[model samples]
Target: MKRICSIYKSPRKREMYLYVDKREALSRVPEGLLSVFGPPQHVFDLLLTPERTLAREDIHKVLANLEQQGYHLQMPPPEEEYIEHLPDELLRRNDPV
Candidate 1:
């Protein structure tokens, strides 16, 4: 087990960055770290929300627990651009004819 040197998270960007020293052995990866995407959605929501305020240690615990639970942590795809519903006339006018 390697001690994490630092964890960087950019909420606006919605990501968690883990940094460990090169010397630490990282052979055993946490399980829940990757499987948090299923039925119990709150965990996944908490992870992705930009308002995360957990203490660093608490965050680490949560992540480690997630990994142990076989939850795989994945950087979800970039959020798709929101498309507003425009009236047909407006869309038509905006379109090049």
Candidate 2:
């Protein structure tokens, strides 16, 4: 199915995005989620199809979520080389898993 999608960025979290059907807008998202998500910043609008490619999330999965849940939340990628940030003392105390 073809759908016109609107993407919204989360003001509280960088790189976090919310995709929803443009026609329905945010109406389908629950109020509780909106509270934690803070205010949504409009990102961009696009026409979605099963074969469309997204920069991060799988387009097929995104489409399925939009159809079933009426919205899809794209979380930010984990910090790169996060282990490097750990204190040397902590790294030395633990065995590599």
Candidate 3:
């Protein structure tokens, strides 16, 4: 199956995204989620298919959630993951002089 999805980024959280059917928009997303998400910023629209590959998310899971729950949330990677990629110089910048 194929679906056209609208992607929105969270203003309050970096790398947090919300996906929903383009036709249905945010109508299906819960209000409580929206409150914490802090008003989604329109990012882009993408055509999703089983064969398509996503950089960080599983395409199949995203499609399944859209089909079953009408929306899918993409959360930021763990803080440790971010720290793992920091350059040694940057990591040492906070060291007490």
Give the candidate number with the greatest lDDT. Answer: 3
Q: Write the per-residue lDDT of candidate 1 for residues 1-97, one digit (tens) a residue.
A: 2222323232333454332222332223343432332222221123322234454434455445444642223343455544343566577899988
Cα-based TM-score, every candidate: 0.26, 0.84, 0.83
Candidate 2 residue pairs in clash (backbone atoms < 3 Å): none
- Global lDDT of each candidate: 0.37, 0.92, 0.95
Tens digit of per-residue lDDT, candidate 3, span 1-97: 9999999999999999999999999999999999999989999999999999999999999999999999999999878866666887686897888
Better of 1 and 2 by lDDT: 2
As a TM-score, model 3 comes out at 0.83
20: Cα error in model 1, Å: 6.4
Ranking by lDDT: 3, 2, 1
RMSD of each: 11.2, 4.2, 4.5
Model 2 lDDT at residue 88 = 78
